[model samples]
Target: MMGRTIFIDPGRCIGCQACVSACRECDSHRGKSMIHLDYPDEGRSVASLPTVCMHCEDPVAPCAEVCPADAILVTPDGVVQQADTTRCIGCANCVNACPFGVPKIDLQAKLQMKCNLCYDRTAYGLAPMCATVCPTGALFYGTVEELRAERPGVQVADSFTFGTTTVSTGVAMVVPADKVQWPVPGGLPVVEINGKDVR
Candidate 1:
């Protein structure tokens, strides 16, 4: 459904970058990927987090609020469109304003690039490329209610406080259980990779 929201379950991510690759297939972004795969801490563990535009629901998104040229637009469905090429001045205000760090300024094109949630596909009742190709079900395509029903232990939060203002987003983040205890020592268990033990 066009109204369906995206859910990200960081626990299920495997650092494969399939979502990142699929994002590049969107026609709107062409060869550039709007999704970013991040390793919050490499030394602690190998877990990864795939981040897309949170599609903030603030009446005036931080990016749009900071854009001097008014190039960024938030649609009725809460999808944040890429900055208009004609109006965008390659200024990094949008990039700096985003709390999730989703927006990027294209130096060559002089425009801001960010995930539009595969509008072309979602508008047609199709899944976004990233959600479609995610093997771990980390990048989910469903409603907030559905995600909550299926994952009772995880809390879904759409609003976050950045400094003084609170920003609401269309996308929901699946928060892991508080004070989660891992069975393995130091979070990651020593495992054998090939013929040697990896610790």
Candidate 2:
């Protein structure tokens, strides 16, 4: 099977929040949006970057590694899932361990919540809700070849470096054609968009 995954193109984002709205409609999200948009420069630019679970691959999942409750699950296909509510103890370990800063502690539910790439839909061979509704194709769900064919000038990068630690992820980011590995200054976990960094 050709591997299908989400590819994020920060440059293509229009701050429309369509992806966020679509994420909220997913049944697993329970009416809450797992995706969020980050404005790299709030006062200067209209450019936005959508944040989703990177689903770290190398070193496995840091969130799951630190979970004493073993609540975080990584699918065979390598998607790092949200905490299992029944097993989660609301410890916030996963939230703190995630380098991408994707996990959130739901106050009311007392559970860690994050994007699972809409596994419920992807498992059935459907595009994720966010990708389906993105007008600009900023969030795309497809094979690597498809992405490369569509955007030949962009580099599909899945490896990021934070100080001395490097992480490989299931999801990829579309960056400048010349760049491949993303390096975070001062070991901070932030995504870069058009040369500006944001979390």
Best by TM-score, which number?
2
Q: Tens digit of lDDT per residue, candidate 2, span 1-199?
A: 1279999888889999999999998878768899979896888999898988888898799999999999998889898888998999898998888887788897677888899999899989999999999999999899988887887766788887875787888888887765665532324554666678776
Best by lDDT: 2
Clashes of 1: 0
Taken over the whole model, the C-alpha lDDT of each candidate is 0.79, 0.84
| Residue-wise C-alpha lDDT for candidate 1, range 69-152, written one tens digit per residue | 999987887778889888999988999978788998878878888998898998787889999999988988887666667766
Native-to-model Cα distance after best TM-score fit, residue 190 in candidate 2, in Å = 9.2
Write down the RMSD of candidate 1 (Cα, Å). Answer: 8.0
- The reply for model 2, stretches above 4 Å from the true place, is 181-199
* Residue 99 C-alpha lDDT in model 1: 79
lDDT for model 2, please: 0.84
Score candidate 1 by TM-score against the native: 0.82
